[model samples]
Structure formats: structure tokens, C-alpha cells
Target: MNRSYEIMFIVRPDVEEADLDKLIEGLTGNIVSGGGEVKAAEKMGRRRLAYTVRKFNDGFYVLLHVLAEGGLITEIERRLRVQEQVIKFITVRMDEEEKRLAKVKALRDSKVKRSALPAVEAVAEAPAAAEPAAAV
Candidate 1:
């Protein structure tokens, strides 16, 4: 079954913008050819790393949101591992997180819609208590 994923990778800082674009295209191409869908691709630009990785202090950051099966993700990870320009990378599965967020939002919406009238009524009647006790 397909699932949501976010793959972020850091490439060497010295790489050219053109090369970076090519690399991103290649990865996204792989996903499409592998029967996965590329939902989004973002280049967050170069920035300092919290700590050194592969002896590099900063790198170009890229984020990808995709939907694919587990096997395809594994393959993509393998490709990233072998790409010399990439210094660090991580893959996170977001399906569960998305589902949880949706559930919370639905519950919140239902509660708000259900009690909206009551909340308005309470607010309208709060002036008596909100008064400063007639200046004590």
C-alpha cells in the first residue's frame, strides 16, 4: 500500500545550483518511474548543520514529499546513500501523523460547531460577573 513520506537530504555546500537541480530531478524522476508520486519538492538552500556531518559543516537542504510503497522508499534511501554529493539524509513516514492530525481537527470542528451557540450565550451573559463589583 502507498503511504506518505517526507525525505530530506543535505548535499555538499560547494555544489552548483544547476547540479543540485539535476540531482533533484533525477530523484523525482526515479520516483515517478518506480510508480510513486512526487507530491512536492523544496530546496531549502544551504545552511549550517547543528553538527558536522561527513566532515562538512553546512550543506544544501532539500525536502521531498512523496507517496510510495515501503520498497520504493528503501530504494530511494539506497540511492541517496551512494550519492557522493549528499552528506546527510532522513526519511519519515507521515501517514499516521496526517491521520492523527485529521482526526484531531475533525473532533475540534465538531466540538466548536456543537457548542458555538452556548459559548456565544455565555459570553453575552458574562457582563454581570465581568463587572468590577461596582468598584467594591
Candidate 2:
């Protein structure tokens, strides 16, 4: 089954911009060729790493949101592992997170709708109540 995923990877800081673009294009191409869809690809730019990786202090960060089958992820990870410029990488399945957020949103919307109903009823009743008071 296809599932949502978030991938965050750090590339070596010294890599040229052109090379970085090529790398990203290649990775995205791989996903597409593998029958996966890339929902979003974001270049977070160079950032200081909390701890040095492979003797480097800073790295280029990239984030990708994708929907793909489980096997496709393994293929993508394998490619990342083989790339010399990739300093670090991680992938997380976002299906559960998406579901949780959707549930919370629905609950919030229902609460808002419920709260509005009482206020509307009160407003409707107020005009009728004031009519009798004004007549008296």
C-alpha cells in the first residue's frame, strides 16, 4: 500500500549549488520512476549541525514529502546511502500523524459549530423576549 512519508537529509556543505540541484532532481526522478509521487520538496538551505558529522560542522538540509509504497522507500534509502555527498538522512512515515491531525481538526470544527448553535438560539430568543417586555 502507498503511504505518506517525510524525508530529511543533510548534504555535505561544500557541494556546489548545481550539484545539489542535480542530486535533488535525480532523487525525485527515482521516486517518480518507482511509481511514487512527490508532494513537496523543500530546500532548507545550509544550517549548522548540532553535532559535527563526518568532520563537517554544517550541512545543506532538504525535506521531502512523498507518497509511495514501502519498497520504494527502501530503494530511495539505498540511493541516499550510496551517495558520497549525503552526510545524514532519515525517513518517517506520516500516515499516523496525518490521521491524528485530521481527527483533531474535525473535533475542533465540531466544537466550533456546537458553540455557535447556542449563541444563535440565544440571539433568536432575545428578540421575542424583548417584544413582551416592550409591550408591558
For each candidate, what is the lDDT?
Answer: 0.90, 0.91
Q: TM-score of the candidate numbered 1?
A: 0.88
lDDT by residue (tens digit), candidate 2, 1-136: 8999999999999999999999999999999999999999999999999998999999999999999999999999999999999999999999999999999888766655655565566887555555543453
Q: How many steric clashes between backbone atoms does each model show?
A: 0, 0
Compared with the true structure, the alpha-carbon lDDT of candidate 2 equals 0.91
The lowest-lDDT stretch of 10 consecutive residues in candidate 2 is 127-136
RMSD of each: 6.1, 8.1
lDDT of 1 by residue, 85-122 (tens): 99899999999999999998887666556455554668
TM-score against native, each model: 0.88, 0.88
